[model samples]
Target: MVLKRIFTAIGVAAAAFALSLSAASPAAAVPVDAPTPVKSRIEAAAAPDTAAEPRTCRARFAENVNHRLRAEAGSAILGSIPAGTWVQASCTRVAGGEYSACGLSSDFWMEVYWKGNWGHGAWGCVQDWEYTS
Candidate 1:
């Protein structure tokens, strides 16, 4: 009778342990992989894609005259390109020398390729208006 009581008690304790494990919240479970914080996940989603390549841009001289390409925007002239000549350039624009040609109001310049070298040149209303999307 005592052995029977001892086995019954052991069985009850084992069942209680099993019940405790089954009743445990998922939050209490050990993670198979290390967990990342919520803030880290949110920041990763919000971060700008640094892997994206910059847009390839191009420019052409507006008139029959040659336009000066400068070492820097609005700086010393490095080279020249004749009108209607198209050259590869950076899409990024900056405020530089004021130009009124082709009714251009934006004093914008962009890095351009001329004579196998990169230089800065006007990318104003003329270039914008001449090229159609």
Candidate 2:
């Protein structure tokens, strides 16, 4: 009986001590010399340029032809695009390089007819219009 009473007393004292500590400890207490918060140096980059600016795309010079006068249907030719063949492409992502689809307008992808061939130029070699612009 005495041992039981001693154990009960110990448990009660422990509980009381815990309660006292919890009650006394202030979570928001500031230290005497709190360091000032550093202001962030970085700011958000300028909002994505939303205003559509008028731009001109040009055709490749005669000296730098993009495709041969009669490029084979199934070959990937590169050089410069011919003049007077400028077409507006639907702008997609314009980062370091432009990402676009061959569109008739802002949202009109065109399907070119290549004799017996069908595919897109994933390389997206920009035409002369893209270069001058």
Candidate 3:
């Protein structure tokens, strides 16, 4: 009788474990080799225009802000914007995305024309958070 009771308890435990595993499994599982449909859809829907109308603003760079070739934080750094140098910035939304930098609340990129000793007639991108208008 004791052996039979042990066997029944073991069976119940096994069934409970199986039920827990099935409940933990995702309802719909995508194959590992398959492309992610949602990510592609989001990217397609968030594509930004390069020719969007830019807003003009005069901004002063923060103490540690540098100019970048692209709006992304990992882009190539062109040069540093000197503190107290008021730059005429043409602000535009980033293509397909937004960026935050220098602890400011804006997510736009400001294109500033580089002049003086830095580089002549070159444009650089600064995150909106890195500057104050």
Over 1-133, each residue of candidate 2 has an lDDT whose tens digit, in order, gives 9999999999999999999877744644645786533211111112237636753333222222234222232335433333344433323312121223232112111122222333222122333324223
Candidate 2 lands at a TM-score of 0.21
lDDT of 2 at 79: 36
C-alpha lDDT values of all predictions: 0.55, 0.34, 0.48
Runs off by more than 4 Å, candidate 1: 1-51, 64-74, 125-133
How far does residue 7 in candidate 3 sit from its true spot (Å)? Answer: 82
Q: Kindly indicate the candidate among 1 and 3 with the higher lDDT.
A: 1
Q: List the residue pairs that clash in candidate 1.
A: none
**Per-structure clash totals for the candidates:** 0, 5, 0
Model 3 per-residue lDDT at 12: 100
Q: For candidate 1, lDDT tens digit of each residue in 19-62? A: 98789687777668874333111112221255365456566656
Each model's TM-score, in the order given? 0.44, 0.21, 0.37
> Candidate 2 — which pairs collide?
57-129, 58-128, 58-129, 65-80, 66-80
Pairs with steric clashes in candidate 3: none
Off by over 4 Å in 3: 1-56, 91-100, 104-106, 116-133
TM-score preference between candidates 2 and 3, better one: 3
